[model samples]
Target chain A: MSEELAAVEETARRRGSRPIVWLAWFLLAFFFVNLAGIVFSAVVDSFGDNWFGNWLPQVWTTHYWSDAWHAYDLGQVLQVTLIVSVAVVIVSVLVGVPASYALARRNFPFKHAIMLVFLLPVMVPPIAYGIPLATAMYKFNTITHVQIANSMFGVILANLVPAIPFVVLTMTPFIEQIDPKVESAARMCGASTRKIFTRILLPLLVPGVLAASILVLVRTVGMFELTYLTAGTDSETLVVKLFDSISGAGIRAPQQSDAMAVLYMGMMLVLLVIALRFVNPTQLVTRVAEERDA
Target chain B: MTVAPPAPAPARRHRPPDPRAHLSHRLAERGIDRTLWLLLPGVVFLVALFIYPLAYGLGLSFQPLKSTDPLYNYKQFFTDHLQRDTIGTTLRISLPAALVNVIASVPIAYRMRGRMRGKRFITTMLVIPITLGTVLTADGMLKFFDPAGGWFNKTLFALHIRTPDQPVLLINNYWGVVISLIISGFPFAFLLILSYLSGIDPSLDAAASTLGASPRRRFWQITFPLLAPGLAITFCLTFVLAFSVFPSAYLVGNPTSTTRVISIAAYEARSVETNDSKASTIALIMAVIELLVISVVLFGRGRLYRGSTGGKG
Candidate 1:
């Protein structure tokens, strides 16, 4: 019995020290350390002056933030971003909610095909379609004398393609969760169709609408390729302007770009936290990918 | 007697007949057929914005300038070394980075599955890089992995891993862009894998262990087979995400020819060279490649699980 107990203890010890387990822990630790290190470096460098050849900055200053703010015309950029984001959200909801209701409540021909049509915009990379879209916008602008290209309206329109689809897909699921009988009951009470939608359906769907809008807000703020391709001089959003400053062919201070990046990061962090509170990351990913499947 | 008359005959019956309710009643009598009209605006928006642009782009790709040859732009893309190399460059960075991210996420996700302390917190932290977007991540990489005065080099120097003058070449090359892709791509891959792993029933592993199977044996026989489909899906999604990398490659990479992804080529062809035809050609080619990769992954996934009886050996 004593010999058996000793052998079991030895096996347990060996298993605990297995190389694979150690490697797993080590890699996890490395991942966290690297993640923390990179974020910290950016934050520190944004505030540092002359941070070369040293482990830490010799002097810290808020001058880089000011420089990035003024040099990038961030005030205008923020206003444009706000306008574009809000416009995209409002339009997406207006177009998406009704469509979502139809998709959820009605059985139509080529319903699956229509859902797939919505899926294409989200699945494909923006750059693939953005080039031609931008070209078309320019052509449209030239012909119609309506500044679609290189203008705020153009950016908002371009964003609406994916935003509307996203709203439709997310809202379809929400609409499906609600009982259809509620609308029927309102109709039975001699209420009009519009009244049923406004009083009975809208109140119940508000939470879903809010969640969808918040998500669209996050996506619109982070969208780069389409906006970059279509935006004009005065319509550049924060991401586009940041890209221009960084990739532009000129000698600029690294700290200033770092500061701008920090600002972008801060904004995204706030938006994402609010988003995560309302939706699960896993659920969001699967929803975006498998909505058609669902 | 006056109360009995109640004035109802005059006022209640003739109160405009409630047009709102009347209209609603008429609509209800028509059934839900009008719901198709609700779908009109969205369908029109997609067709106008999404389908039209893609179709126009495809059409534009075939029309070459100064030549009637429909394949002129495509032939040029294949023959030109700089343009042709973007495909190779994109694959080289995307494939390995995506593989590493998906494979690395497996063990960590396996360990993280089920009830655990700080799981929510750790998962939230993992998602930060993804939300930070590629531009910010590339900027962070530029600062943290700087060759001259960066902390990574300084730390290596302090630890006697290299001479003070000879810091490791981390940025401005293939590895730099790969690291940035990994940074942004890993969070997405990790979250995906975590969700996949959580879907797997833990009782299978527990049953195997009770039957005297070691942890490795249980994972290989029970867990891995079940996880293969999710892994393939995760790999494909991450591969697509990495394959489309543009800003990060330009920022942290030697963007001249070494890291000129297809998107960069498309951008230049349209913006710099004013050649919309060639730009469309490159974009179409990129789309084709992505579709082929996705199909191959799906095919492999179908094959892997076809013979198994619901993941049973």
Candidate 2:
């Protein structure tokens, strides 16, 4: 009786879902087509000599890429970007992984409050917190005579605000998924806490840590507001440089901006591909939803 | 006699040292074991970098640089039409964009909820915008929606909906920022909603269907209510994202008038005008508004079914 009912329901579902499925496909295609068109337009413009009212540029050239690289001082920008992203990734992972273990494994007082504190940066938009953060950075610079507000150190510090929390958020689920029995087994075998962490947990946590670090690295690379607020002239990252080229008061060619944009997109795409290779697309956000519910 | 009595008492079995006597044991009792030392660096980092600065900024907002009145910055912001109107403009752009993104994401996320063959490919494709970030998306929008040769205008030209002379007014307008927000925000909303939708057990729907409920009826009766809380959260997240839009507004919208959002106003106050106090005040206002919206949505979520919908996250 249940089998017959299930069969009937399955047929009805398949029949009823056709239009809805088509609509879903249409929406997906529409979205991707627009996305591709947007990226394609930038790519073509970056290589094109001039674009007018036409389907494609009449001429194509690589000069814009060369021009943008030199004109924007992209070598220095890329160097700064690399330094900041790497520093942020290392620091966030180092700070976040153990904290994730604590949060995941221990039932502690004010656990929810602590989680909220960690989640605040991820939940709040950057500018909401960034303004105050930048102000404090500038103030610190004046008081301590340290170049924190606009220096590379300042940029790393500001980016860490979000990056560290992101690491914690991503790593918590990974830690939770590891069975507590394994740790207990090691403990019963006379492993000290330090040995348990260094020998057992560390090995188990490699993939999670790598995924977290790569995600943080990508986030740091693209972080604009905090970087914009805190970075000095010499500390600007690629995204910030890209923004300045677009919005700054200067007589710059459109193609040069397009070229820089294409370069920025390429770097982000590379990081994203690497990130997605290790981390499932769903894994990126599911943990966050779980965190919210918890 | 006293000595004999003491000896006799000493013969009683000695209690093993109380486990709680050790600091580690006591801390463990309170859920603050040695393992918690690992949390120290992150907690300290956040306190110094995130919490302290925000607190300092709040304090700074109360200290006007040029005015004796503590409320001077706040007053000036409210009194100034340009600055005050930004609250409205930001809302105008963000509210609808967030709503649209959340609404658009739900149907698609529902359709794509369970195991599907191309789910991974589709999800990865949707995630492109999120990775693209705002600046690139704005650049893309500029070129793709350019009046002279943008593909959008070109499409309009092909469709005869518009001509080269009068392309769809997408870039550097109110709508442009909203569109950019939707494009960047929809992917996030979809990912979030999909995760939430997948959290609901399929058996409930199957049960509903077995009782002879139609697909539409089952969705409204069972799935929609279950999804309400997640939708509220998705809305709040997207709203916050759109509300704090800066790069897109600067790159794609009319910054001075049409879409001079609160963040841009705060930026100008801090950077352009070099008034940190005023910037902090505006930043506080922005945070307040965002919290207000979030709390309202969450309050609505509280009214929904509070029990677990069955699938563990």
Candidate 3:
């Protein structure tokens, strides 16, 4: 009697757990299908000559790709994008690396408060400050005639607002993990400060610097709101231009817009792939949060 | 080598009373800290670009349009229907989308909790939408969810769920916006929850099972309680992301009023209406709402995880 009851209980437990296991697999499958479907649909539509009420496009061509390229003036857009991204990366690293070193090594007054100040730009959405930043830029340009607003300089400056802080936060951990005694030892060997920084510290810090710069590059490319608000007709990045192509009150074909999207996606995918090689996405979130809390 | 060093020191001591030495001595006397100087460049940059602008925006929001009523913009934000609906519209979409994403991710994450094959692959796939961003996702949604000849309607027609004439209205509506938000928001929420779940020890469940507890009871009694704080935090972060919806709302939904979130309202007030003060008012209100929600979630999390060891066992 006892054996029979145990068997029956075992069977019931299996029955109860079977659906959950099936559900997990189903959810996984659903996630793949949904993500793949969205991405593939865009790619296919971009090349499709005509796709109406069909599982596949009736015809495919590369015509829209060229059309989007010239019609959107993508050459200029891409040039501006590269220029802005590179400038933001270089300036942020120059400004952030030393600050990160200081933050890692020093005990200072109002350190937590200062850290929170850096955190604000990142934690808060860009739109919160973007309006006023744009306004100030416009005001500055009108007053000084320096033309920072609606220019490439303005866009780079705007991108740097978040980029610098991100670099500081990410590089602080990298700097912290290194032993400070190494630097002191280099100094004790009668090396000048510049030699210590250039010869010893730079080599050890290369991996972290590379990771931070790659992330900054990715962010500058993907940043939308600030660029959208600040970019002029001549200075729009890929993302801002893509937004214009979609809603710019022009009578462009949807396929052409899809093509532009595909281009944007291509650029982002390459950068993201590179970034993932250096940093885990899970660790990325935790690092950002941990810095804010600390 | 040591004799050469001593000869260099003699030359420096006799080098016409070095001006740089006096300057260095003065600087040292004034307590010119190197670390402070090192931090100055970044500090100046952030203050000039970030802090000044945020403060200016707040100050601008309080300025009166007529120079008579100091509270003009604030009053307008509350009294004006169009401005006021933005708050309601933003909340209506953001709250439900965030809640749905959090709730839906729980069961899926719970099921995938233990060591499983392809977990990394699954996570990578999930992160694709986030990388794609809102612009790409909305663009794809426009094509996929088209009513007349889109894949979605075609599938529905073939499935006999709806006739050709009665195609479902998926895009340019409230549900369409909500669905798009979910598509983008779910991946992030799922990643957070999965990471949280991984931090939980598996032995608790094993112990519970050995004690004759069923799987369902083990989950509810042991796992769910421990997961509450993580759930609260995940929901708060995702909620902030959803609340700031701008591109998707504009691209896929009825942005005039139904899906006109506060970001849109601020954009219009500043760009279309060219009213910086009103835009600042809207932006500040949005920030306040986000902060309030986050604080509430944190407080609740403190209560939930107050003495619990988070199952480090």
Q: Against the true structure, what is each candidate's TM-score?
A: 0.86, 0.93, 0.86
On TM-score, the leading prediction is 2
Please write out the lDDT profile of model 1 over residues A170-273, one tens digit for every residue. Answer: 88978987899888888999999889978999999887888888889988998988999899999999988888878873667878888888889889999888
Q: Evaluate residue A94 in candidate 1 and report its C-alpha lDDT on the 0 to 100 scale.
A: 97
Identify the superior model by TM-score, candidate 1 or candidate 3: 1
**What value does the lDDT take at residue B4 in candidate 3?**
47
The chain A TM-scores for the candidates, taken one by one, are 0.87, 0.92, 0.88
**lDDT by residue (tens digit), candidate 3, B124-221:** 66767777778888888777778887777788899999888999987788887888888888888988887787767666666676678887887789
Tell me how candidate 3 scores on lDDT.
Answer: 0.82
**What CAPRI grade goes to candidate 1?**
acceptable
Candidate closest to the true structure, highest DockQ: 2
lDDT of 2 by residue, A1-294 (tens): 387877787688778778887887798788888889999998999999757878899998999899998999999999999999999999999999889989998988899988998988987879989999988988888999978888999999999999989999888988898899999999999999889989998898988888888888877888899999999999999999999988873578888999999989989889889988877776665553222232
TM-score of chain B of each: 0.85, 0.90, 0.85
Which ranges of candidate 1 are over 4 A from the true structure?
Answer: A1-19, A105-107, A179-200, A288-294, B1-32, B211-213, B304-313
Off by over 4 Å in 2: A1-7, A17-19, A288-294, B1-24
User: Could you list the iRMS of every candidate?
Assistant: 3.8, 2.4, 4.1
For all the predictions, what are the DockQ values? 0.37, 0.59, 0.33
Alpha-carbon lDDT, every model: 0.83, 0.88, 0.82
* lDDT tens digits, residue span B1-313, model 1: 3555544455464344355576755454444466778988999999999899889989999998758999899888999998898999889999999999998888888777666688877777877887888888777777787888778888888889988778888778899889888888888898888877776766566666557777777778987888898889899889878888888888889888688888899988998999888888888888888778878998999977533323211
